[model samples]
Target: MRRKHLLNTFAAAALRIFMLLTLGVMMTLETKADISEEYPDFYTGAEGTNTKGINFVQSITVLAPEYCSSVMGDFTVVFKAPGMKYIKAFCWRQPTDKNPGKWGHDAVLADMELKEGEMGKFVVKGDEFPNGPMTIRIHAKDDKNKQDICELQLYNLGGVKWNQGIPDRDPPGAAGMARVFADDFDGPLSISPDGMNARYAAHKTGGGDFSGWQFSDPHGENQPFAQRDTFLRIHASKPLGTQGRSGILSSLRPDGTGVAVSIPSYFECRFVAQSAPGTWPAFWTLTKNTIGMDKNDPTFEKISKMGSDELDIVEAYGGYGHKNPNSGGVYSSVSHFWGQPKPDWNQRKLADGSENTDFKPSSFRTDTLQLGGKSSWSWTFHTYGLAITETDTIYYFDDIEIGRHPTGEVSKALPAWFLINYSIGGISGWQIDMERYGNKTDMWVDFVRVYSGCVQAPEVSASGFPGAKPAVVTMSASTRGAEIRYTLDGSEPSEKSTLYTSPVSVSQPCTIKVRGFGKNLKPSPVTEYILTTPPGVQGSIGINFVTDMADSEQALAPGDVTGIAPYIQGNWNNVLAGTKTTSRFSTSDGATSPVTLNIEGEAKPEKGEPWGFSGNDRRLKRGNLVSNPRFTLAGIPYAKYDVVVILGAGIHNVQGEIHLAEAESGNHIDAFSFDYGWNGGQHAIATTKPGEAAKNTNYIVFRNVTQKDITITMKWGSGKGWTGVAAIQIVPQKD
Candidate 1:
């Protein structure tokens, strides 16, 4: 990082922050296909204004997507620069670091001029770097300040050879890419006949040294990855030990992923530095273009030395405990390893004929970032990320950026495989430094999220009215040739999760979680839809509002028993303490005398018990309102339909009550009574219904709880003039 380029670079960086905040980007876990369509404009930078006459790179604006990790792909970046002659671009990880352009700060790498009159453009074709999010600093060759270039737009034509060898299903094969594969290494790793895997290693059949590492979950602990306290422990063996534990990519089959392996991909993972004298934790990727070497055999070293590309996102040095001296120091670097440096062919060999130190690309790191800004690596967990493509590669830490570079070297021009592991003694570094480190240590990883590939998850929407039960909802995806997978249990969807082939019928209030997947693309981010069906209700229920008749407005409407959005509806005014005298009328079948409430001698409330209705009688607040009749009927079709009335909370201290009703056939029905302590909630006053299922299960069933209907005149036997009320649920007893 240099001193002179601080203000200008950071200013541009500030603009990028603003863009990420306002733009809507697709935050994916597994991805493939077009990076631009999968995420947002943050991958290509902010759209610059038409303001021309610009020369310096400071005049350019960047608003790329928050993430873009296309390890191999072709895309075109279009820009308008009427007065621009030549363009030079530079990118360094640290905003404060000045060694930005790999070809110095004044080299012209991409030309932006064409004949007499034409807009300039930068084409990142298939022949580029490993993968994504390159922070480009472009300037005109003629002007010292790039002020002539105005607008910029990027259109990703999808990555080249994204997933080549995998057998594509016939007909509607893999129409969508739901989270088909992912492994937190939490529960026991499951190997099956269907070939679903999340953990892998090249040499040891995707399990590293076969037994060096183990997946552990003590039945008593509260974690799989419970923050710093508890997490998946990938413990390592002795130094120079054969095993290396890792996870992240799913294609490390011992059989090899032929040429054109994975599509342009985004790789990310969070890991705590190893704690021990002989521990080293790392997250890295390898280019698929390794033609001469075999990843598992001893001959790999010699072959890789000839020519190979590997990107080390993070490689912590050996460390012990949380101590600084034993840990991987205060910073980590993003290095690109491409064969040995010029004339360094013998660097891969050992004097004793035993494999020794291989050439370390420490001197050629694209960018280096200070860990926790001057903190030890093993002390905490940090995120390491890399987005690479054929033409450029970008690095990130904790979601923020490290820097980017052009595909200047040939090794960076190929697609790559991913890897995550805990190793002890390796090439140029970590040894069993027992003096400062502990003998046995473990790497605790929170979780790893790879944001590569693209899957336009389904967008859910509900249609029809709330009054209808078993609501009909549809799930659609914006990605072409995508299918939706969904669940109603509030759990995330995977390839094995329930597949949504058509409109869904939701019979209760539930959360509908869905994801979209395309043939070759990764699954889209999860989209949660909360669906609720308003209970079928009849006329409006009255309320006991404490407000005076003068101040309170229309709190109750005319209706025998109305219903809508919820189980009950009413206003407070109708239930005022002394607003209306307690009186009940007989059913229309026969003219029976009305009954008056026998007010108990000013009911005494327990000294400490607060009144259900709060506030003074003169004010119309929430506390001063109660449902009228202290109860109400809730159902529809107004005919002779059976149902059940389940007493809710409002009956705690209710006094005595009675009900006289006539059956629908004009015959006298059974009388009902309630003792002083027996009231609302936990009490079901069952009525006769047609056919019914087990009532023990949960569901807001409105049909089939009762068999017949009755009209009744119910009166309070004892209590103040006002009736205490809670909820009155009327579920249809007969479906």
Candidate 2:
């Protein structure tokens, strides 16, 4: 991978250091005794460093419904606590992780009149909570407000079977997508030598994360990771007092190669954690830039052309003190953009440097979501998910979308590998109190899964317009391994429809509907096209710039004037100049025009797979600063026609000028500048939602131009710019 620029790293690091250094001061102003008020024994920041002599309550022990027991129906909590005025019980439904401070109860307590002498029994129903791990808190307090709280850890198997492991249900908004990867941890997570067959690695390749202080491999004969009973447990502990050791499982292997999900993809993890003080647990993904890579590696070349990015699906910091409240019940979804142009939303700063503006760091952004209602993630296995499309990145908790942002440019450009880890207090200012839990904690992962974006809709094209002669129509799908199905009568195409193996001939005007299907994938959205001969002169041409030499070259199509629509490639940063092409452009009148096109100066071709677009629609030629590429179209039959120029750079945005002129006379026809805007870069395609037709101000029109040949020149806009042209069309204007 390309060596990360140190200037960007130091600039972002300086901001983080500033936050760390000022956290204490911020805490002083924002910290309140959110938990200490209920439990006087709960430690808060010391003011005098002296102990209070108040009377304290003794310990209580649960006698029935043992720890880790799976409860399905009604159950009684029988505990023992003598010399107490009254005892009360309530289910604090532990957060996905356990902490020492007081916790809130989700299930109501019963039989409040019961006394401790009678062995306190409070009836409760196991069905009151969702199926997952839970915690039952027993409280006993004296008149002096000093209280002793005890908790019982167990699982509630009310709605789900005990041995079923992680649920196999698909997440929301996953329609039409296909599962690309899945692991339930039913077997051991062993490391393979080359990381070819192994599903995981102990750490990221080449030694990154926590600076060697955490996620150590084989800590003194005790591996920090243990997989069994359909769950992968990551144990965190302070083995040497000052050093925090734990384990991490990455999709990347030791050789820096492993499973990665590309955009238009979804990744998710279902897990429970111990949200105790000082514990940090997370489910996240990073690009190859995070792993150690050699310049000669095959993938390194592709990665070198892109920037780095990180997607933190969930970051749960465990603590109940004033600085960290709600613990695992609340988590953050963060994204980092490294060594790339920052998105527009991340460009804000205090103009005068005198005011504190609500702005994220220049390199990162974060948003938090809470489970709410006294429920914490550590209390049970909750699914944390991330969906990445070309335009946006969405975060989901338990299948519910929590936050969304414009997809990072780097994220859209590169594939991402995932990681899960349990860390012991390092950077998350929340103080560690693991001594109460034996200086160790665990984060349980039930499963990790990945899904590719939906199969793109089938694109239909014709060799000639339907009229006096037969027109040969062809169809294609962008999703690999997908099968095209179609219908001639405009009916919805199903698996029972005619399977498309080759081009089909249409004798007359008719409607054709098509869809694509693949194994383990949701069916592609259905598309319908009407083929007919029109009086207006009509034709279109798409230019393909080679990025991957292995890609099959797409040929020029007749391109219907009635708008034949379907689907979506990005090339690297290099520019190609002086490319030429000559082709016969088919028209609606059943005649062909010999068109010769040539580009002068620098130009770039986009060939990467863009979501929701395919074939020639996915291709575009772009021009940049210093060289405005000019395309000369010769041999066009003399006629007064309206010329339409399609804009957009596939996944990238373009802001520049499109100038039309007579090729032979050198007389300018028209010229104007345009901007595709941020995030929503490709204006002609719906990169946010698959299969939806997105059309707006994505085309420029030069009306009633009388010319046998024309020249189109693309120049970068004044400020931030690149000029992208995907396709061009010519239609005769009515006299």
Candidate 3:
């Protein structure tokens, strides 16, 4: 029974082991199959197609690419949409380093719709991303529903990268800097045989070069054609002569059928003398009619009608120490206006202190300063330029503005062709170098650049309080050819704004907006100003007074008393008075009685004839009391006031003096004083006080009065002056 049981158990155990082995084998095969289906070998469209029918489904991936590190050129993505008239595709990118499957918001690529039955490929160019792993997603819409798909990998193969679809590298040989205009001339111009050829070659080569045009006697053999007034004269020796000529081999003359190029309204012309003992070279513009024609020709009427203007862009006289004559420097730029005769051009003083009074009709002269130690006349290639506009004319030299002339009154007849020449020998009439006659000196021409039109000034605005009549404002601008226009309304101004005939009027407060338009009709920034009306006032008055010697005593009174009795009794010395007594007298019925005192003595006049005592008692004798009393009333408003003064009239020398004080206690205010003789009179001197009410009740006083004067009289005494007494007072109106 035991043996049979053992056999069964063994059989059961074997069966279990076999079952376990089978299950293990199945699990291993399942895991291998799952990994193989989930992850396939990475391939980019650039490498080749993975499977034809099982399209890469670019719509299922990011817009750009993944693994674009090796991407070069453009990849054509082909896809199809069924039953749709039109289809559109958009591309996006996902970085493999972070959020490998998630796309970013910035669209790296996009494309318009593709027509039905049209099989198009979207190009995935290189440089879309830098060397890195990226996932490209594409969305395709076919009318109704949208289908999204993707590609696994793409790359930049040409060492280029793209971040957000922008190239990662700059183009080869790009320095990332701006180019500057060539303004400095340091080398010699490359010259050729022919004059025109030399100028053209120098311009092409772009340095400093010379054309074989001389400004000496053109009739001489081996010399170019002598074109009078058209050619510039270049001299190697000092003190340029009045008469210098040169030859210009140009078949075209200013009067001929040559093309008329408009002169710029603004430009700079600069010339440099290359030699240290520099030759003064002058570039002048002359009317064609002035050339080879007598000064008194009948046809000159037609010729003179062709007005010509010249600008002395620069002039360097050899006598001016090898430098420019005008500025006493190496470079000088000046402008000339010659439409009509003017003092600036025809009457200018030369370096020799002589005036150039003879009008050369249509001639403009400029020069180049000296440089280095050579005697060469080196011209700035394009240093000087001219501009002509409908409104004005401007000249420039070496990029610096020389001058400007308004064309408001002048006609706009364009100038003919220009000439460049150098002069050698001439008569010593204007002091030419006789020894250096016929010296070979060259005037180099680099290039001539002509521009047209004028630069206008900026615009300005007049803004202030609204509705206030008489509102004033000032407008300013910076420009060469602009006029100011303004409007009072808040509305913007067009060409129709009120033209600023003059400064704006501010009778009423208003907001005025202003704008400036250039010759090109372009408006500038608006400038603004605010204006307001002033306030007003009511009435006016003035005051005047006189002081005598007795008045001085009243002024020196000890206290602020209005009456003068106490001063006479206490200060008067026995030398001026034999006795002193008071009498009752009154100008008005007041609580106090008015009293007059009498004093007598030998009062003498000092040398300046009608002499009176110096009101400064401390500086005079007892018999001749030096009493001149002057007072400044403080805190007084200018108004009218009643004034009263009394003087004692008797037989002693007495004269009165009075003066008005300014608002402040100084000599800054004006003063007026008068002398009076003591003849019996009602008040010796009195008038309504001027300049408001006296804040400090102060008055001028006199010294030598000795008697009572109910009747006041003033007289001039040839002998000892008379005596006077009493008081002065002022009262305000009750109103």
1 versus 3: better TM-score goes to: 1
Ranking of all predicted structures according to TM-score, beginning with the best and ending with the worst: 2, 1, 3
lDDT score for residue 341 of model 3: 54
Candidate 3: tens digits of C-alpha lDDT, residues 188-295: 331212222122111101112222222322222243221111112222222244333333322122112221222333322233332212234444332233433445
Tens digit per residue, CA lDDT, model 2, 1-735:
111222222222222221121122121212232334544543323331211221233346677876445677888877777665445554543333343222333444642433546677777777655455566655564333233445455666663334236565677745457765678888857542123334566655545565223766532223677665677767666655456678777777544445665677888988877655566778888875635465776877777767788788887765543333322244667787766776656656444654445443322222221233334565556678898888778888767777777788777766678888776665554556655445656677888887777555666777666654577898977566889999988899999999999999998788999988888766766767787664344343333334433322222234412222321111111113234554564455555557677677566654332223322333232221123667887876646776666654433344556788899898987775565444332344212221222223355667788888899887664444343565556665555
**lDDT-superior candidate, 1 or 2:** 2
Better by lDDT, candidate 3 or 2: 2
- Sorted on lDDT, best first, the list reads 2, 1, 3
Clash counts per candidate, in order, are 91, 19, 122
Candidate 1 lDDT over residue span 592-686, tens digit each: 22323222223221111111211121111211223323222222233333322222223334433333234345454443343323321123342
lDDT of each: 0.37, 0.57, 0.31
**Model 3 stretches astray by more than 4 angstroms:** 1-255, 263-271, 274-278, 286-307, 319-382, 408-411, 414-416, 424-430, 434-438, 453-735
C-alpha RMSD in Å of predicted model 3 compared with the true structure:
42.1
- On TM-score, the candidate that comes out on top is 2
